[model samples]
Target: MLLPFFEWCENTAIGETIRNSLWLFPVIEAVHLLALCLLGGSLLVVDLRMLGVGLKGQRISQVAGYARPFLIGSIVTLVCTGLLLFLSEAVKCYYNTSFWVKITTLPIALLLTFAVRDRFSLRKSFETSAMSRLLGAGSLTLWFVVAAAGRWIGFS
Candidate 1:
């Protein structure tokens, strides 16, 4: 069903231009990676805080709140660049297992990021700490899979 859309995307002018360009692809990929780093770093701080490590001076909620905008911004950047990257090679991605994996996990990661934030920060219950740790671990694991699969797309 979506194959036709992918075909259309690959044939689009933007995709053709990027795919044909020697330098544009690399430059855009670099920006995508930088956005990944920003996303990972911001997530790490909040996850680590939940894990009972790092920034002990600040509350977990504080760390999470601080990282929220970074998360949102980096996500936006990643999605834009990622869409360009995908548009350039939509057919290739359609056949790539790693791309499929990333696609599957990415939405879950996005939902978990915000849902966990709301649950972790807004709750006053004592179990919030344990719950935060659990959610943090899950978020980290899902994101790792997403990142690893994304990287694997280059190799596969």
Candidate 2:
């Protein structure tokens, strides 16, 4: 399904134009990297709070509320730029193991976010439970793997 869609994209005039631009991929990759930094930074703070490592005075909900916009913006930037890059090398990425690992981790991280969000409550939000700390550690590990896998794409 995705292959056909990607094939169509590869054949389109827009795709041709995008592919022909010598600097487009590099520019997109740079933006993706910058977005990654932003996302990681914001998530790190949130995770640290969850792990009882920082901002212990502030409520978890308060921290999450403040970071939500930054997190969403960074993720949006990452998605758009990442898709552009993937489109440029769709067929290759479709088979790359590192690419698969990175793609796989994305959903896991999202699921982790949903789990953490669901676990958050008025009273519970104030207390960083052990489960929350474990979840935070898991989220960090998954993101680390994703980043490492992405870097491996260059060599593999």
Strongest candidate by lDDT: 1
How would you encode candidate 2's per-residue C-alpha lDDT over 52-120 as one tens digit per residue? 988888877777778878888998898888878777777777668899899999888777776554356
- Candidate that scores best on TM-score: 1
**Model 1: lDDT to the true structure:** 0.87
Error in Å for residue 148 of model 1: 0.2
Model 2 scores a C-alpha lDDT of 0.78
Candidate 1 wrongly placed segments (more than 4 Å)? 122-128
C-alpha lDDT of all candidate models, in order: 0.87, 0.78
Minimum summed lDDT over a 10-residue window in model 1 is located at 119-128
How many backbone overlaps does candidate 1 show? 0
